[model samples]
Target chain A: MKISLNKKILDKNEECAMQNSEFFADNDILCLNVISSPGSGKTTILSQTIRDLTGEIKIAVIEGDIRTDIDAKKIRAAGASAVQIETKGSCHLSAQQVTGALMAIPAAGMDVIFIENVGNLVCPSDFVLGEDLRVVVLSVPEGDDKPIKYPGTFAKADVILINKIDLIDYIDFSLERVIADIRVVNDKAEILQLSATTGEGMENWYNWLRSKITQ
Target chain B: MHETMVAQSIFESIQQLTNEHNARAVEATISCGQFNPINDEVLNFAFDLIAKGTPCEGMKLNIKHIPLSASCKQCGVRFDYDVYKPGCPDCNSMEFDFKEDAPLLLEEIELEPN
Candidate 1:
C-alpha cells in the first residue's frame, strides 16, 4: 500500500515562528534577524548600531552562538540588554529557542530586538527566528562571490550590508559585481555599503533602520 | 549538521503515518527544491543514523530534486531555470516572484500490511 503524506518537514518551526511574529506585533516591537559567515562583522555592526541608537531607541539583543557568550557580552557592553543562546553545536538557532530568549529578555519597553543568528550563511537561512527584517552581512575581505556562492542566504535577505568597505582600496573586492550578483538572486533587497570600523556610510544604514522602525 | 534535524522530522512523520494506518513503512519519497542548500548525500547519511533503533530503520529513502521556477513580475513570463541563473530568459528581468517549487515534502510512503 502507498500512503501520501505531502507534509512540510519544517512545519513545526514555521508554526513557532508565526507565533513569535504575532507576539512581536502585539508588543509593537521590531525584530531584526542578523545572519552571516563567521567574522563577517555582524557583532561589530550591531554594537555600533546599538551605540548610535542608545537612549533614542530602546534596543535589546539575543545572541546565538555555537559555544560562547562573547558576542552577547559585546552587545551588553555596547549598551543594550543582551541574552545569550548557546546552541551546543547546533548549526542554527531554531524558532523554539528564540521564543524562550524573547521571554527571558526584558522586552517590555524595547523598540527593537535584534536576534544575531549563528554565523553560518547556509543553515541560518533555513530557519526563521520571527523577525520583521532579515539582514545579511558580507565583509569586503570575504570577496564579491559570496552572493552567488550562498544564494540561499542572500535570496532571503531583506537587507544586505557590504561591511568593511574602508578596505576596498587595499583589497581586490568588486563592489559592482557583488551588487549585480545580489540583484540576480533578490531584486528588491536593499543593499548598502558601510564600514563599521571607520563609521563611513553608516548613516545610510542607520537611516534605513529608522525607516523600518517607522514602517 | 542541521540535516540531522531534518531527518528526525522525516522519521517522526513516517512514524506517525505508520501508526495511523497500522502498518510499517518500507520506503519513503521526499522532494526538495534546487534552491535549497541540502546535500542529498549528507541527508541520506543523517537519515540512516537517525533511523537506527527505530521503526523506520532500514527503510529505503528516495529523493526528488525540483528545479527552481519563477514568474516574471515585469513581463509576466513563467520560466524554469537553474539556481545559478535567476534572471528571466525571455525578458532579461530580475524582477520576478519565484514559485515555492522546492519544498521538502514527504511525498509518499510505501507500507507493509499488518
Candidate 2:
C-alpha cells in the first residue's frame, strides 16, 4: 500500500528555524545571515560593521566554522559577543544549530544579530537560519559570471555585496558586467560594492544595514 | 556535497514514518525544486549509502525535479523560468518572483507490512 506522506523533507530544520524566528521577533532583534565562499571577506565585513556601529547599536554574532573558533575570537575582539559553532565538517549551518547558538547567546538588549554562515555559497543557500535578511558576499576575484553559475545563491540574497573592489583596477574584473549579471539573477537584491580592506564604499553598506534595524 | 546531509534528513523522516506505521518501506517519492541546487545522482548515491545495512536497504527512490514558475512583476504574466535568462518573458523585466511551494517534499512512500 502507498502511504500518502506529503511532508517537507527538511521539516525538522524548518520547525527549528520557525522557533528561532519567533524568538528573534519577540526579542526585537534583526538577524542577518551572512553567506559567501572562503576568503570572501565575511569576517572582515562583520568586524568592520561591528566596529563602525559600536555604542550606536548593540550587536552579536553566531559564527559557524568547519573546525575552529578563530573567527569567533575575531568577532569577540571586535567588541561583540559571539557564539562559535564548529560543524566539524558540515558545509552549511542548519536552523537547529542556530537555535542552539541562540540559546547560548545572551541576546538581551541586542539590536542586531549576525549569523556568519559557513564559508560556502551553494550549501548555505539551502539552509535558513531564521534570519531577517540574507547577505551574500561575492569578491571581485571570484569573477563576473558567478551569478550565472550560482544563480540559486544569488537569487536568494536580500543583499549581494561585491567585496574587494579596491583591487578591481588591477584585477581582470568588470563591475558593470557583474552588476548586470546580478540584476539578471536577482532583481531584488540590493548590490553594494566595497573593499573591506580599504573601506571604500562601505558607508553605503552601513546605511543600508542601518535602515533595516528599528530603534 | 551537502547532498549527503539532504539524503540523511530525508532518510530520518522516512525512518520516523516507517516506525509509526510499523511497516517496511519499498519505495519513496520526493520532489525537489529547481532552485534547491541538489544533484540527482549525488542525492541518490548518498541516500543509498546511508540506507545500506538498515531496514530501508534496497528501497527504491524516485525524485521529481520541479522547474520554477515565475510571475512578471511588471506585466503580471506568469511563465516558466529560463535558466539562461530568468527575466519576465512578456515585459522583459528582471523584477520577477518564482513560486516555490516547497523546496523539497516527501510525496509518497510505498510500504509493506512485515
Candidate 3:
C-alpha cells in the first residue's frame, strides 16, 4: 500500500516554538536567541551585555551547551537569573528545551531573556527557540568569509555582531568584506561591530537592545 | 549531530503513518531545501540507528534536494540560486525573499499491506 503523508518533520518543534513565543509575548519579555560558532566569544559578549544592562533592565539567561555549566555560572555571576541546559551531545537547543528552561526561571518582571544557543553555525540555525530576535556573532579571528560559508545562520539572523574587533589589527579580518558578504545573504539584519573585551562599539549593541525592549 | 534528531522525527512520523494504515513501511521519501544544511548520508545513517527493532527497520530512505529559488529585488529576475552563493545572478542583489518552500518535508511513503 502507498501512503501519502506529506507532513513537516519539524512540526513538533514549530509548535513548541509558537507556544514559547506566545508565552514571551504574554509576559512582555523580549527574548533573544544568540547563536555563533564555538570560540566566537558568545558567552563573553552575553556576560558583558548582562553586566551593562543589569541595573537598567531586568534580565535572565538560558545557556545552552553540549557540556558543563560554565557559561551559565558566568551569567549568574553577572547578576542575572541563569538556567543551564546541557544537551548531552546535541548540537542545537530545541524549542522544547527552551520551554523547559523557561519554567525554571522567573518569567515575570524580566524585561529581557537571552537564550544562548549551542555554539554551531549549522544545526542551531535550523531550530527556532521562539526568540524575538536571532543574533549571530562572528569574531574577527574567524575570518570575514564566514557569512558566505555559513549562509544559513547569517540569513536567519536578526542582528549580526562582528565581535572581537580589537584583534582586527593583528588579524586579516576585513569588516568591509564581511558586511558585504553578509549583505548578500541577509540585507535586513542589522550589522554591528564590537569588541566585547574592550567595550568598544558595545554602546550600539546596548542601544539596539534597549530599542527592541521599548518597541 | 542534529541529523540524528531530524532522523528520529522522520522515523516517528513514518511509524505513525504505518500504524494508522496498518501496513509496514517499505520506504519513505523526504524533501529538503538546498539551503537546509542537512547531510543526506548522515541523515540516512541516523535513520538506520533510530529504525532498529521497529517496523521501519531496513526501510529505504529517499531524499530529494530542492534548489533554492528567489526573485531578484532590483532586477525582478526569478532564478535558482546556488546554495553556497545565494546572491542574485543577474542583478547581484542579496536583498530578496525566498520563494515559499518547505525546508524539510515527508512527501510520501511506500508501505506493504499487512
Candidate 3, B64-97: lDDT as tens digits: 8877778888889988878676678886777777
Ranking the candidates on lDDT from highest down gives 3, 1, 2
DockQ metric for all predictions: 0.64, 0.64, 0.68
- Order the candidates by TM-score, highest first: 3, 1, 2
Residue A156, candidate 1: C-alpha displacement in angstroms: 0.4
**Per-residue lDDT of B108 in model 2:** 92
Candidate 2, residues A142-189, lDDT tens digits: the string is 878888878778878999999999988888988887787777657778
The lDDT for every candidate, in the order shown, is 0.88, 0.86, 0.88
How accurate locally is residue A3 in candidate 2, as Cα lDDT from 0 to 100?
Answer: 82
Model 1 DockQ class:
medium
lDDT of 2 by residue, B1-114 (tens): 268877998899888877887877889998877668567899989999999987688899998877788888889998888767666778788777767634688899898876
Q: How do the residues B77-104 of candidate 1 rate in per-residue lDDT, one tens digit apiece?
A: 8888667766788888777787764777
Indicate the docking level reached by candidate 2: medium
Q: Which pairs of residues collide in model 2?
A: none
Off by over 4 Å in 2: B71-79, B84-97
Q: Give stretches of model 3 more than 4 Å off.
A: B73-76, B86-97
Q: Could you tell me how far off, in angstroms, the CA of residue A37 lies in candidate 2 after the best superposition?
A: 0.8
